[model samples]
Structures are given as C-alpha cells and as structure tokens.
Target: MEILPGEGVALVKVGEHRDVVESRIGPPVHPGRSSRAVYETSPMLVLTYTGDETVELVELADGDGDGGEEVFFDGVQLTSRFMDDVVADLEAKGYEYEETDIGYRFEPGFAVFSMGSRWARDLDPDAAEDDPRRVVEGVSVAPYEYFAEPAEEEIEAYISSRQSGGNR
Candidate 1:
C-alpha cells in the first residue's frame, strides 16, 4: 500500500463511500462498527468512515510478520523501517513535524505511532540498536486539518458537553 499523506492510501482515497471501498478491496475481514472496517492485509488496513458513510481516515498497522503486503511512503518501506531512520529521512526531505509521545505528526496529514520501545527495559542493550519496538506500529492519513489545533469554540463545546454529561 502506498500512503499519499493528505490524499489517501493507495487506491482508497478519502471521501469514497464504504460501498466503493468494499467493491475495490473486497469485504473487510473484521467489519467494525457502522464507521469502521478492518482488512487483513499484510500490515492490516483500517478504514474509518464518517456519518455519511464516506471514508474519512486510512490507517495501516503492523500485523503478524507473515510478510505479504508492504506499506510504502515516498520510497521508504514504513512497516519495516526504524523510527529514528524514518525521522532522519523526513528531516532530510524538509518535512515539518511535531514529535509526539509515541511518534511523529507530520504537517501533511501523516501521523506515525511507534511501538513501546522506550519502556522495554528487558531488551538487551546491544540488541536495542535494532529493536523491533523501534519500528512504526501504525500510520494514519487524514485531511490536513485533522492535525490542526481545535478552535476555541470547539473546545468550549466539548467541555460544556462533558460538564453537562452530554458526552458521557
């Protein structure tokens, strides 16, 4: 699968209906709630739909290493590359990003989450250099605005809803 950052992943562009996705990729192995589906692709594919039943987000996550499908961005293989190396490449390419607790959120609607490498105290010090936990655990693509800070009104609405038990 090819991740096109803010656009989409491979042939599954955002804004496509669920029916179109099912027709293109066949049925999902795990049909989730009304808004989500999971395909058992090499690295597992997850599609999230909006209330209108249109694709809103595309995510690829690590699966059992049976090694069938490979996810790529630019020319780099995302599922197998180490997070440090990936970040270095991103820097070289001049992409602006914010470092999160788990991984990185690039400004171009791309976010990567890393495995629990930092908490793996039992790992060998030498092997830590190539630790599997350093690889990306999952990656998601959405609209550029998805990464933007929420508007004050949106935040206030959320707080008010929570206070009133409307979000509970």
Candidate 2:
C-alpha cells in the first residue's frame, strides 16, 4: 500500500496550505494539523486530530483499499511499515503495542490519539486506556508520525550536511 504523506505537511506547517487542509497546523512544528488521515482498508473513514480535545466522526468509505485514491481527504494507504514506524515512536515513549486484525494503534496521541468515533467503539472502552492497537473499522489504526520533527542533533546534522558525491 502506497501511503501518501500528509500532502501539505510542509506547506500546511510552514507555508500556505490551509486551502488543502482543514485544521490549523501545530506548533513550531504546527501544533494542530491532524487533517483527515484515511487509510485503504475494509471500512475507510476520515481520521484526524489537529491537537483537539475531542475526536470528530465523519462517515467516509466502507474500507475498500480505495481510500488512497480519494484526494478529498488526503488518503494515505496504511501499511505494515507505517505501523512499524508508529510502534517505534510509541516504544521510544515506553509504550507496548499488540498486533490486531486491523493495523496498529497506540497511546499518548499520534495515531490512536484521535480515532474516528465509528472506529473507536470497536475496541473495549477499557481497552482504550491500556491498548496500543485500537480497532478502527476492523483494522488496526496508526499515525504516520514519520513527518514529526527529528531530534535536535539530527536536525542540525541534516541542515549542515551537504551533498558530496555528485558524479563520483
């Protein structure tokens, strides 16, 4: 599954990208740009969380793998690798995730932080607090946190680093 990165992360985060998205971008990294993050699955829907206190519910597709095809919501095809990244970030925060029949879910916001209401009820209400992988439309839900800010040194190294080998 080819998942599209939040189409305007940079634009939405830094430049003029509001027309493409709904929520306002978050902090220095833009504090709230959880635009609908739909994934290709059996029952797809608009998933988003732009640093809001409550999650919003929108009736989208019925999960048909075509979620990625829709440009209206900036569909990002959910894949195992994507889930791996989410798990990695969560694990960094000392969180453990259990694989589900769906995709992947975690705590402390990221992916599991703001799941669609239709997607939220699938799991045990008690499961939300303890579960790392909440069920969303029969699929595990996760965040494409790959767009998140990197560590300071990492950022510095990247900013200072330059292309060396050109014709070599």
Candidate 3:
C-alpha cells in the first residue's frame, strides 16, 4: 500500500469495539493498548488507530539539521484504492464499517472514503461537523494529482500551533 503524500495529523474516528486494525504500513510501534495503536510508517509519517479504523495521522517534517522532527502541514493524502483496500481488509478481518448516503461513516461526520485534494483542506465552518455531502455524490473513488507543498507560512503556523499543543 502506497501511503499518499501531504502533511497533517488527523484523528480518525473508530468503531466502539477494540480488536484488529488493518494497515499496510505494518504492525504498530505501540500496540499494548486495546483502544489505540501507533505506527511510525516512515521517519516522517506517523499513524494511529483504534479498533479497525485509523484515528490519527501525524506528519513530521525533516530534521532542522539538529536532528529534530518538525511538525508541519494541515494536509495529508490517501488514495481511492487505498481506501477500498482498507475497507476490504476490515471486512476480511471480521470488522464492520457503515456506509451511508454521505460516505463510509467515520466517527459520524468524517469519512474514510471521500474526495479531496492530496493536500488537506479545512472544513467549512458552516457545514455540519460530519457532513458526508461535502464530496460530490457523497463519495469519492478516483485518483488525484499529487499535491504541491503548502505555503511556508501555513506550514510554520501549523507547526507552531501543534508544538503549543493545539489540535487540528
């Protein structure tokens, strides 16, 4: 599974049950907890899961030459095929995921299968917290062009807020 590129640490919504989580990034770096597991997919990317669903994705920018990870980007990417494989894997592993008119429901309003740019974008403040209608036709299953990097100001602000313990 190709982990798409961009940046951000998103909290993925998960089902109530705690059991297996299906991921191609491999076993988690931390798996002792029944509610969550964390995986460092690469030196730059970190993923977290609860039950069979992903709950968070954190992107670490390359070291500042002093060998420190820098938090950056409010954007991240996951391909359509990747979403399908995750659902298929969940089903194969005996997990159930609910699909609705909006998209595959993830924590009520969010979705594991929806459309957007490779880069993450802010939700409209006026939109409902869990609106699946954000996407055209309520679902997305196509590839998108890779994202160009976000502005330095955006990156810096995101990093600063993250370091100050703000949640995105």
Candidate 4:
C-alpha cells in the first residue's frame, strides 16, 4: 500500500458515525457497510475487510518527521538479545489480532502517546483506554486493560507473601 506521505486519520468521536464512510486508494474498497476500510495515507492504500464495526489502521510508511521515510524498528535484532536482557522480567504474554484491515486490536495491553507524539510501549491504563483513535461508529469503547488480571502464579505469590507475614 502506498498511502500518500501526508495522509492521516481523523480520530472520530464516540456515538457519531457516518453510515457509509468510504475510502478509495489503490482500488475500489469498502463499497458498503458489509466491510470496513482502513485508509493509510503515508504508505498508501486502504485495506478493506469483512468484520464487525470499523477497526482500521492508517498504515504509515517509515519516514522522518519531514515525510522523508522512517525506520520503524531499529535495534534488537535476534530473539537471544531480547531473551537475555528484556524477556527476563516478563510473564503471561500472548497475541490477539483484531480481524480488521484498518488498525489492530491489542487486548489487555496499553499504549502511551502524547498530544503531538506517536504511540509507544507501556501506556498508563486510564490514559491509553481513552485514546481518541479508538472508536467504533462514533462510539468510543473501552480498551482492553492490560495487566488487569493477575496470573495464577502472581496470585499465589501474593497469598504466600501475606501468609508469611511479609510486607505486602
């Protein structure tokens, strides 16, 4: 997809939606409500798919802030590198993909982005769940709360600590 360099998405408000929000990029996509379209401006092309509601993504091509191309992921090449340094502190992780061409749905996770900045990893739950980019037919739905539920081991650990008369 070759979204125009200056293409961007309008974060819609909840409870206000167009019955037929259309998009035409490389070809005829999203001719009706039966499918949702995710329009990308930078990298170009809108992805059309069959699903519930409109959860599309504007795929931005890697570019500099000046629209000169960007490098999406820079460092950390191999699994070994992450496993040795980063993965050690992690537990209970899996992937759940939203079946849409627009954007992706990350259940039980968080994102952080400033007013004029891009999103980043590990967002504040209260804040991330309130991202303006997240909406369906003008209705803002609740974002999946990451780390809301404790794993079994974490629960057991908590119990053990309390029972052991240790500081909580």
Candidate 5:
C-alpha cells in the first residue's frame, strides 16, 4: 500500500468508512469497542481503528522499549527487511520523526506515533522477565502509559548498554 501525506492513507481517508477498512485489511482479531478496535495483521504488526471507523494507527513492537510507534496509513506484512523498507519510505516522504531507544516516532496526524514494548511486562505479571514474543508478536494499541517519555539517564543507559552488547 502506498502512503500519501496527511491527506489520505492506503485507499481510505483518515476519517472514513469502517467497511472500507475491513474490506482492505480484514476483520480484527478481538472484538472492538463502540469507539475503537485493534487488528493484528501479523505477529509484529498491528492496526488501530477509531470509533469513527478510520484506521488510526499502525505499530511495530521492537526488541526493546524505546522507539516510537507510527501512524499506520496502509496495510503491509512486516518482517525485518520489510520494516526497514517501510521506515525508509516514510522518511523519503518527509515523515518527520523522533528517535527513542526502542524505535522511531513519526510525526502523527491520524494517530500518535510512539513505543509499546514496555507494556509486555504488564501482560505477564508473574513472569521473571518480559516475554520476548511481546516485542515480536502482537500488541494492544489502547491508550496507555507505555508511551511516556523516558528519563534522560534511562535513555542514555539503554543506548550504552545496547552498544556494549549487554542485555537490557
């Protein structure tokens, strides 16, 4: 799918019909609320639909919790190589973005660009560590605290640790 600027995404407008979204993308894995729903097109790629029936956002759960989620405009199956291409395309189109430890946050209009890897811990309270699948599998796009800004020290530490080939 081609990503147009803020005007329209994929084949659907930012705030358009739900049927178009379903037809283009397919039904969601979980039941939706009156206002929003989430679709897991792949283990690592997720799509968000608003109450108004527009595809609001797309998120990629990176290996660590630092990068920003992005506004998804079109459907694309994700793999390591495919993600790189998508990010490059978004950049080529002049999508303004910010860097984080985990990923990049593109400037968003249809949806907020931000990271969700941190939320993996919440899904398994008793586990010794976050399930790695949480970052590689699907994630919920609900409004949550996972997107909060990290402290400067925390960000620096994460980068340093990653650079040193240490686990975070």
Candidate 6:
C-alpha cells in the first residue's frame, strides 16, 4: 500500500464517502460503530469516518512478522525499517516533523508510531538505538486540520507571552 499523506492511501482518499471506499476495497473486515471500519488487507487497513460517514483518517499497520505485506510513503518503504533511518530519510527529503509520544508527526498529515516490545506499553529504554523494537508499527494520514496549529487567539497569546519572556 502507498500512503498519500494529507490525502489517503492509493486505494482511498480522505473526504471520500464510506460507500466509495467499500466499493473499492469491499466491506470492512469488522464494521466499527458509527465512524470506523477495519479491513484485513495485507497490512491491516483502518478507516475512521466523520459524522457524515466520509473518511477522515486512514491508517495502515504492520501485520505479523510473517511478512504479510509491505507499505510505502513517497516510494520509501515504511514497514520494518529502523525508526531513526526512516526519520533520516524523511529529513533528507525536506519533510519537517515533530517527535510525538509514540513516534513522529510530519507536516501535511503523516504520522508513524513505534511498535515497541510486546511486554511493554512503551518502547524499552535499554534497547539499542538500532533495535527492531523501534521499527514503525503503523502509519496514519489525515486532512491538514489534523495537524494544524491552534486557533489564532491561542497563537497570538503564545507569541505575546514569548515576547514578554513569560514562558521563559
């Protein structure tokens, strides 16, 4: 599968209706209540819908180590690669990102999370930087608003505070 960032996967795009998605990929493996659907594709596909039933978020997650499928973003393979390597490649491509609690959130609506160890809720701190535990586990794409900055009032407040050294 290929991620289109602020758009959607190659098979579906954000803002597409649920029926359109179902027609292209068939029915979801498990229909979620109201606003979500899960499909049993190569790398499992999950779609979140808006109140009007249009796709709002698209997620592709790595399946078992059996290598069920592969996923890519802008031609760069995402699944199974080390987290740092992926970040480096993205940076090289001029994609700016912010480190999230789980992984990295890139501009224009792309985010990836680490898998971590099965026994731990978070990544194992003692694991080597190159450890497999740090490979990307899942990737998500959404509309620009999903990664947009706060409201203008909030931004102005923050700017004013910073200028006054209130936050320092």
- Candidate 5 error regions (>4 Å): 5-13, 34-36, 40-45, 60-96, 107-168
Error of 5 at 92 (Å): 9.0
Model 2, C-alpha of 15: deviation from truth (Å)? 28
Question: Could you give candidate 1's per-residue lDDT for residues 13-106 as a string of tens digits?
Answer: 8899988888888888864556788876656778889999899998888542446566777776665556777778887888788887778888
> How many collisions per candidate?
0, 18, 6, 21, 7, 0
In order, the Cα lDDT scores of the candidates are: 0.75, 0.35, 0.35, 0.30, 0.45, 0.78
Write one digit per residue (lDDT tens) for candidate 5, span 7-110. 33443444556787677767666675444444543233345566666655544333232333333344532222223455566677776655445444446432
Q: Taking the tens digit of each residue's C-alpha lDDT, what string does model 4 give over 1-168?
A: 111212223432112233333322332334554443434444332332324444332233222234433211113111111121212222223434232332333342311111223332112234554444321111012234421356899899989989888654
By summed lDDT, which 10 consecutive residues of candidate 1 come out lowest?
A: 117-126
Which scores higher on TM-score, 1 or 5? 1
| Model 3 misplaced regions, further than 4 Å | 1-23, 33-36, 50-52, 61-168
The digit string of per-residue lDDT tens for model 6 on 55-160 reads 9999898653566686788767776666777888888888889887888888868887775743222335576555444677788889656855589998999899
Top TM-score model:
1
Candidate 3 lDDT by residue in tens digits, 16-84 = 122333333455566565344445533333334434553433222222223433322112222222345
Q: What is the lDDT of residue 117 in candidate 4?
A: 30
Residue 89 of candidate 3: its Cα lDDT? 50
Which candidate would rank higher by TM-score, 5 or 6?
A: 6
RMSD of every prediction: 3.7, 14.7, 17.6, 18.2, 14.3, 7.7
Candidate 6: clashing pairs of residues: none
| TM-score per candidate | 0.79, 0.22, 0.23, 0.23, 0.36, 0.74
Please report the TM-score between candidate 4 and the true structure: 0.23
lDDT of 6 at 23: 87
Candidate 3 pairs with clashing backbones: 7-75, 9-57, 11-55, 12-55, 75-120, 109-130
lDDT tens readout by residue for model 2, 38-155: 4333233444444442223222332323343221212332322234444555566575554433444333222322243343323334545534542233222233343234789987
